[model samples]
Target: MPQINEKTWIIIAVVIALIGSLIYNIISAKKLKKKRQQFTRSIQSSYTHMKTIEDTNKKIYEISNEINELIREQKDTKGYIEKKKKEIEQIRQMIVTNDTILDCTISDKRDLATEKQIAFTYNIPTGLPEIQMEDVDKIRLFANLLDNAIEAAESVPAQDINGKNKRYIHISILNRGSNFFVTIENSKRTEISVTENQFHTTKLDAENHGRGVRIIRQIVAKYDGTVEFTDKGDTFEVAVML
Candidate 1:
């Protein structure tokens, strides 16, 4: 074989160096691409996790609102229960003695009377009349009527300096001709109006509040009683006969 020349040897060395550099560049590029792919996947995963957290937060907010509404309703129910207990005690005493006077008065909140307010008076007969109704029925009738009156009164401005409208409630119970009659009257704000056979609410959102009248009507119907309402445009009156 012919001896290699120095110039040829130098050329061979240069070629080897170029091939090594090319191989190194290809390997580096592949490693960089792999790292970039991994980084993109990590970013996508973080985004997905963040979206999940946001969705969960939204659901929690909705649930909290519903819970708050339910709590308010429960508080109102508890207040009604307390009132009923006191009224029941009075009724029981009257039942035993065959005669008694029942009176109740509730104040409004903020002196605005734009909340549940109640006042009622009932005079039992000196002697139990024949065909006397059950104590439960009587209690139901009185409680429902009083509750409705309170709800109506709560809707109006307690003191209207501008005479916008004054809230008023008057409830009286009478026993006549073997039947019991109750009358409730209240003043309403001019802008608010309630129609018969439909629920009227003072709440900002009707869907959230206003079932007192509906429940009262149901109770009255159960006793073969009649409920009638008179809408005076600025005032309302309800009567029940049992």
Candidate 2:
């Protein structure tokens, strides 16, 4: 309990005030640091949520594309089924016929490619031996042949080839020794595909179509005949011997 000077008391008061201010500033700095950490955590959480949403959206997009592809496939299948029904009917009729070429005049090779601007020629002979199979088979054969010829000839626009336009078909039927020979010659094929003993047409008509050569082979084999397909650079020929 000593008596203190006023100046010393003032000095003590100033020191206490400075210490209090320092404590207050340190506490405030700790509080600010904690707040900043919380803000950083909040931002990270928001980013993670956005990433999840983005992944979900991507999955949904892929699912939508798959669904669209499935729908297109179903539509194509329906069209194919409808087309196959008509083709089946025609094949059935061709299978259950008993008519012969001698039973009637099979007139199918006249101006067959007229609409396609393709020149057609023929030397079909009369009084030939009747075909071993149904005459309907023969009709189908000729129709398919002429159609393929027109398709091939029309693919290459009528152009000058060495001096002449080569968009024409020449078909002949005659007797060779003891066998009936059917020969078909048409414009040269710039593009042709042959596999084994089968042939394909130029049209991209579905899978069920373009089987003309297969049908022709079936008919020829059924009648104990031999068929030949030759590609001669500028001309194509098919010969059937029965």
Candidate 3:
């Protein structure tokens, strides 16, 4: 303030301008960083929302399939009441004729295969004690396997390319030293689809299907057993050891 020179005034002006510019740059950088952070949070929130929507859609799809199955079952109850009555009587008769629950289940499924024109043959060990399993498990395991086999065999043509009838299911049971080996083989028209070493159902009603194999696997796993699926082009075989 004591009579500054012109050159000193210009230098002071330049310094003030430099300081102002530096402060402006610092503020701009902070604002830009805040905006970038906000953008990142927005992207993360969008991704989370998208994933939530996807999961919700998956659950809705599962619920829809279950609803559809329940509706079909209700319709079936109305349409097949008479057939179910006949089947009940047949089941009673088969229960009277067969020795064990397993035998009855196999016989019932075999009769169904016969009606479908799919031959069923089973060679169960004679004089062997009933399979060491709970009655319900035995029925579930054998019934599910035979049901799937019969369904697949039914899809096979009445006569194969060789002009011979090969639509059949063959089941063999062996009493190993400490285990039971059961094998079910059936005719197939096309190659089976396998995913992650598991057989995928080829049935048109996919949602209502697929549960059978999963049930069978659960039963096998309950007994610490192993189930193997082998596809032989013209035939598919499922072998279980318990």
Candidate 4:
């Protein structure tokens, strides 16, 4: 081989340097593209994780609201149960004594009268005969009658508007060998409406107001008893014999 010239050697060296530089640039570009792809994957994974956390938080909030509602309902149910328990205790006492009317007067009627500012009086003998009836029937009979009398007494305006002669209610029960006589009298307002011997309610709620008399009549009829309604102008009286 002939000796290479100086210029040709210089040209060959420059071309070798150019080829190495080109190869290095290609390798660097490939590494940068791989890094970009990894960054994109990381961003996508973070977005998916954030969405999952939001969904879980939303479910937790809904569950908390439902738990609060259930707690409120439970409290209401407990209060209702307590009220019924007191009523049951009162009924038990009435049954044990076999004196439903007297018990009603002592318990509910007396308290109601006191609260409504009405004068309540009752004449029950010490040795009154035991009522010969079922506990339920006895309770229904006296409770309905007394309730109606008390309601009517509340409607009567104070005498002379000076509240001098306040409204009054009186109850009397007497034993007559085989049967009993029961009477309830109460102060009333004048201008009572009577349709076919039945008194109409003067209350604003006409639908629910007039059912008490019917119920009382039905209870009396069950024991072959008699009930009379007498509206004495300013005073009303209901008499029942059983």
lDDT of each prediction vs. the true structure?
A: 0.56, 0.62, 0.74, 0.71
TM for every model, in the order presented, reads 0.43, 0.49, 0.56, 0.56
Off by over 4 Å in 4: 1-101
Model 3: residues with Cα > 4 Å off, grouped in runs: 1-99, 161-163
List, residue by residue over 1-242, the lDDT tens digit for candidate 3. Answer: 59999999999999999999999999999998976775565456445545644665675576567558868777544544454456445433332212255555676687799899897777875555567776556867888899888878877889868888879999887776768899999998675555554766656855544788899899999999999888777788999999
67 Cα displacement, candidate 1 (Å):
59
Winning model by lDDT = 3
Worst lDDT 10-window in candidate 2: 95-104
- As for TM-score, the candidate ahead, 1 or 3, is 3
C-alpha positional error of residue 71 in candidate 4 after TM-score superposition, expressed in Å = 60
Residue 33, model 1, lDDT? 95
Question: Candidate 1's C-alpha lDDT?
Answer: 0.56
- In model 4, the Cα lDDT at residue 200 comes to 74
Candidate 3 residue 26 Cα shift, in angstroms, is 67
**For residues 117-205, could you state the per-residue lDDT of candidate 1 as single tens digits?**
33333343445343244433343445555555555566665556874536566654567787777677766655556575565555665
